[model samples]
Target: MRKTCLDMVYELAKADDRIVFIGSDLGAGTLSEMQKNMPERFFMEGVSEANIIGMAAGLAMDGFIPYVNTISTFITRRCYEQIAIDLCLHNLPVKLIANGGGLVYAPLGPTHLAIEDIAIMRSLPNMNIVSPSDAEEMKRFMNQSKEIKGPVYIRLAKGGDEIVSDPKNGFKFGESILIKDVGEVLIVSSGITTKEAIYASEELSKEGIKAGVLHMHTIKPFDYKSIIKYSQKVKLIVSVEEHIKNNGLGSAIGDVLNDNCYHKMPKLIKLGIPDQFPDKYGTQEDLLKYYSLDSKSIYESVLGFIKSKGLKAA
Candidate 1:
């Protein structure tokens, strides 16, 4: 996903000189061609991440579409005030290319982990959040970023997942994809967690549980209507993500259920990491297994949760 995003953005920069790229000390090897080609438009600000956003804001004010790239924690958490006051205040079209989103940096410890970035960015007024499931969605979202006139956060991941979305699928900015049979068990997820949900759905099919997977690429301005419709039909709704449960996708869907007046709604289960720092070092896959976010654990947990609720499978 990261390579696809950079490839498309570099292509956009070639035809138009107005596209400026800014990086806060990252991906030096991959961006060598871009830096050599467009030296004037590319800026390599040192470790000062806050200043990078400010510079991007200034460049945007001067008729440049500045795209900032950095680690997830540094981009949102470190320079939030700058984003709010400098960029979002003017509604600048600054594309945020954030890598290592969620718990992708499990071995680096909690400081490098961005478990709450989605929740933090969703609170900003004019921020547009896009969590693409794979490389195909990343390319589509990059094309859509050109049309949007405000701050946009584009979440990226390491590639090599199944292509759940086709290139011919109608692409929109703030839409959701319902990927399988619309049954009584609906699984809503974003980012790489979408892949985990897909695996769990396939496992559930073996038990005669027709699980539905909704890949929510967009977080802010969520498609509440679709969420409520799925919630009504499903006997159980499970939200899976790599982010913290609080203020993440799960909480957002819960709010939609409340507003739509679905008092007797299906049981909603939030699956993700708990609210605590990690004590030991491990790989991303190990952390997932420890958190019970792998395919087998997720499938078993969903079945157990549903059975405990005394709900019949659809």
Candidate 2:
């Protein structure tokens, strides 16, 4: 998804002179082509994330759509004040392209893990939070960000996921996509974790437990209607994400369920990173397994929860 977003951005920038790319010590060989094509537009500010964001905001004010690229943790956590005050307060159309979202940077330790970026960024006023499920979704998302009037935060994965959304359908702002049929269990998920949820659902189906999956590509301005309708049909409602339990997709959906007070509401389960920071360093897959966020772990958790409801213990 990050690669796709970068390609799309470079293509758009080449065609449109008003577009520029800004990087915070991430202008590796991956972006060499873009720099070669538009040297004046591409600037690599070494590790000064706050300055980069401020520069993007200023560029936005001048009618240039500045795309700021960096790791999820540094992009949001290190430059919160600049994003909130400079870009958001003035409603600048600065596109924040962040990589290593969720546990994508697990080997780099807790400081690099971006579990809290979504929760924190989504809370800011006039900040549009977008986490497209795949590269195709990201293409549509990047195009749509240009049309939007306020600041937009686009969280991209490390790539290598099969496209689940149709390009012809296009992406609508503040909307959710229903990927599969309705089932007894509804898995409402965002980002790459949505893929994990789908695999877990398929595994559960083989065991005679049909599961429905909803890919929540848009995190902020979530589709509450879809959530409510699905919540009524399923016996279990599980929200899976690559982010922390607090202020993430799970918490957002839970808020809607609680507010509506829908009768016979399905049991809500939040599957994500827990409160504590993991001390050990490993690969993204290792961290997911360690935190019980993998497909097998998710399957077991969901199955165990369902069994617990029936007073069955193995």
Candidate 3:
């Protein structure tokens, strides 16, 4: 997904003169072709993440849309003030390509894990958050990103994920894609977790349970209308995400349900990392399993929730 995003940036730059690429201590060959062809527009800065945010803001102010690349933790946690003041405050057309979002950097421990990136970025007023499910979705999102009017936080997962998205369904920023039709239960997810949600839905189907999958690639400017429309048809709503349960995708859905579906709110179960930092270090899959965010665990959780609520299959 990261490779597809940067490749699209290079492709976008080739067509638009106003597009610029900015990297903070990335690989020498990150965008070798773009750097070789457009040296003037491509910039590879040092380890200063905050400085790069300011630079991107300046470039955006000068009518150039800058695409900044860096680790998710560094770009967000290390430069919160700069992102809030420089990029989001002015609502610039800067795309923040955050690599290794969520627990992708789990081997490096809690400091490198971007478990709170979504919550952090969502707090900023003008910042938009997008977590594509896979490379295909990333391509679709990047192809249309230029039209968005403000700073965008493009959350990326580890590459080589399952291609669960269908082109026929279409792609639109700030809109939720209904991967499966409405059923007795709905699984709402973003980023790589959407794949797990799909798997869980299939597993539930095998047991005479009816479950649907709703992929919310764009977190901010969330598809509230879809949530309201779907929630009315389901007995339970399960929200799964890679980030923390607080103020992440689950929280966003909760807020929407509270404001719009007060009287007829469905039972919601938020599956994500807890508020506390992880104590062990391992692969992304290991952490996900530990937190019960894996496909099997998600299936079990949803099954348990349904049994507890006495929701019958349709």
Candidate 4:
């Protein structure tokens, strides 16, 4: 996903003269072809993440769309003030490509984990957040970022994820895609967790419960319309994400449910990291399973949730 996202930046720069690329202490040969082609527009800065936001803001003021790439923690947690003041305050058109979102860098420990990134960024006005399921969807997000008026943060997962998103359907920044809507059990998910939701749908089908999957790739301008549609159709609604349960995708959906669904509203089972630092080092997949985010765990959790409500299985 990282390569695809950056390559699209390089690709976008080829066409639009106003497009520029800025890196915060990235490695050598990172977008070398882009630098070779458009050296003036490419900037490989050192470890100063906060300074880069001010610089990107300045460039944005100059009518150039800057794409800033760096580790998620450094760019967000470390540079929150600059992001809020420089870019977000002015509503600059800077695309922040945040790498290692969630526990992608689990081996690096808590300092690198971006578990609460969404919650923090969401608080800032004019800041838009998006998490694409895989590389294919990342391409779509990058393509649309050009038109976004304010600062947009694109959360990127580790590359080589399952291609659950179909390119034929394409991708819109603020729209939610409903992969399937069959039974009363609706599984709402975003980012790589959407892959698990897709799998859970199939597994639940065998159990006489035809679960549906609603993929919310864009989180900030959330598709409450889709959530409303499913809220009315399903008896049980389950939301999943790679971030913490609070102030993430689940919380956003919860707000929508509270405001819109009163009578006959489906029970919600929100699954995610339990708002604590990981206890051990492991791969991303291992960490997700440790948090009960694996497909089998999610399937079992949803089934248990359904039964807890005294709802009979189909």
Candidate 5:
């Protein structure tokens, strides 16, 4: 997914002279073609995340659309003030291509993990948050990202995720994609968690249960209409994300449910990382299992919720 995003940046730069690429302490060969071809537009900065946000802001002020790339934690946590003041406050046309979103860096421990990135970015005004499910979706998103007028936080998972996104569904920024129609339960998910939710929905189907999957690739400017539409038909709504439980995808959906579905709100279960830092070190998949965010765990949790609520297939 990260490669697709950077490659698309390079591709977009070829046609649009206003587009520029900035990398922070990345490898020498990260975007070799772009650096070799467009030397003036390609910038490889040091480990200064804060400075890069300011630099991108300046470039945006000068009518250049800068695309800054770096690890998610450093970009969001280390340079939050700059991001908020420089790009978001000005509503510049800068794109923040964040790598290693969620637990992709689980082996490196808490300092590197980006479990709260979504929540942090969502808080900033005029900042758009996008989490593509796979490489193909990233391509579709990057194609349209240039048209958005404000700053965008592109959350990228580790590469080689399952390609569950279909072009037939159509790609629109800030619009939720309904992978499966609403049934007895609706699984609202973003980023790679959508894959697990799809698997869980399939597993539930075999046991005489009907489940649906709604992929919210764009977090901010959420699709509240979709939640209200699906909530009316389902007995339960499950929001699954790779970030922490508070102020993340689930919380965004919860706000929508509270505001619009007051009379006919369905049961909502938020499945995500806990509030504390991880106590152990492992790969991304290992950490996902430890946090009970895997497919089997999601399936079991949904089934248990249904049984406890006495919800039958509709």
Candidate 6:
């Protein structure tokens, strides 16, 4: 997914002279082709994330669309003030390509983990958040980013994830994809977690529990339209995300249901990492399984949540 995003950036730069590439403290040979092709527009600076934000903002003001790449934790947490003030506040056309989002860096411990990046960026107005399901969707999202106004935070998952998104369904920003249509319960998810949601939905169906999956790739402009439409069709709504329960997809969906659904809101259940730092060092999948983010665990949790509401499985 990471490679596809950068490749798309390079492709976009080829046709658009106004496009620029900037990286803060990235490894060697990162986007080397773009650097070789457009040395004047490509920049790779040392570990100053804050300075890069200001630089991107200035470049944007000069009619250049700068795509900034860096570790998720550093770009969002380290230079949050600059991001909020310079990029979002001014509504610059800077694209933030966040590397190793969620537990992708779990082996490096909690310090490198950006489990709350979406929450941090979602708070800022004019900031668009997107977590594509796979590399194919990343390509589609990046193609749209050029025309999308305001700052964009593109959360990248580990490379080589399964491609679950289809071009036929259409990838629209701030829109939701109805993966399996509305059923007894709806599974709303984004990012790589959507893969798990799809898996759990299929498994649940085999056991006579009709489950529907809704993949919300765009988080920030929070697809309130789809959330309300799908939430009304099911008896229970289950939100799954790789982020924490607080200030993440779950919280955002709850706010929507309360404000829009009123008492007509269905029973909503949020599944995600608890509000605690990951102290264990392991692979990304291992950490997710430990936190009950795996397919089996999610299926069980959703099924359990359904039965607990005195509802039938089928």
Model 3 agreement with the true structure over 137-211: per-residue lDDT tens digits? 899999999989999999999888779889898889999999987688899999999999999999999988888
| Candidate 6 lDDT, 1-314, residue by residue in tens | 99899889899999999999999878788889999989998999989999999999999999999999999999999999999999998999999999999999989998899999999999999999999999999998888899988999999998999999989988998898999866788989999999999999999998778888999999989999988988788888888889888899999999999999986788888888889998788899998898888888889987897778777767
Better of 1 and 4 by lDDT: 4
RMSD of 2: 2.6
Q: Backbone clashes in each candidate structure, one number apiece?
A: 0, 0, 0, 1, 0, 0
Worst 10 residues of 2 by lDDT: 305-314
Query: Candidate 4 residues 1-314, lDDT tens each?
Result: 99999999999999999999999888678999999989999999989998999999999999999999999989889989999999988999999999999989999999999999998998899999999999999988888889999999999998788788998778989998888774878988889999999898889888878788988999887799999888898888888888888898989989999999887578888989997887888899999898888788889987887777777767
User: Lowest-scoring 10 consecutive residues by lDDT in candidate 5?
Assistant: 305-314
**How far is each candidate from the true structure, as Cα RMSD in Å?**
1.6, 2.6, 0.9, 1.1, 0.9, 1.0
For TM-score, candidate 2 versus 3, the one ahead is: 3
- Candidate 1 matches the true fold with a TM-score of 0.95
> Model 2 TM-score?
0.93
Please give the TM-score that candidate 6 achieves against the real structure. 0.98
Better of 1 and 6 by lDDT: 6
Q: Least accurate stretch of 10 residues (summed lDDT) in model 3? A: 305-314
Give me the runs in candidate 6 sitting further than 4 Å from their true place: none
Q: Go through the candidates in order and give each one's C-alpha lDDT.
A: 0.84, 0.84, 0.92, 0.89, 0.93, 0.91
lDDT of 1 by residue, 73-159 (tens): 889899999988888788899999998888778889989888889989988889888898888888888887777889898877665
**What clash pairs does model 1 have?**
none
Give model 3's clash tally: 0
Q: Is candidate 2 or candidate 6 better by TM-score?
A: 6
lDDT of 5 by residue, 246-277 (tens): 99999998999999999999999899999998
Q: Candidate 3 deviates by what RMSD?
A: 0.9
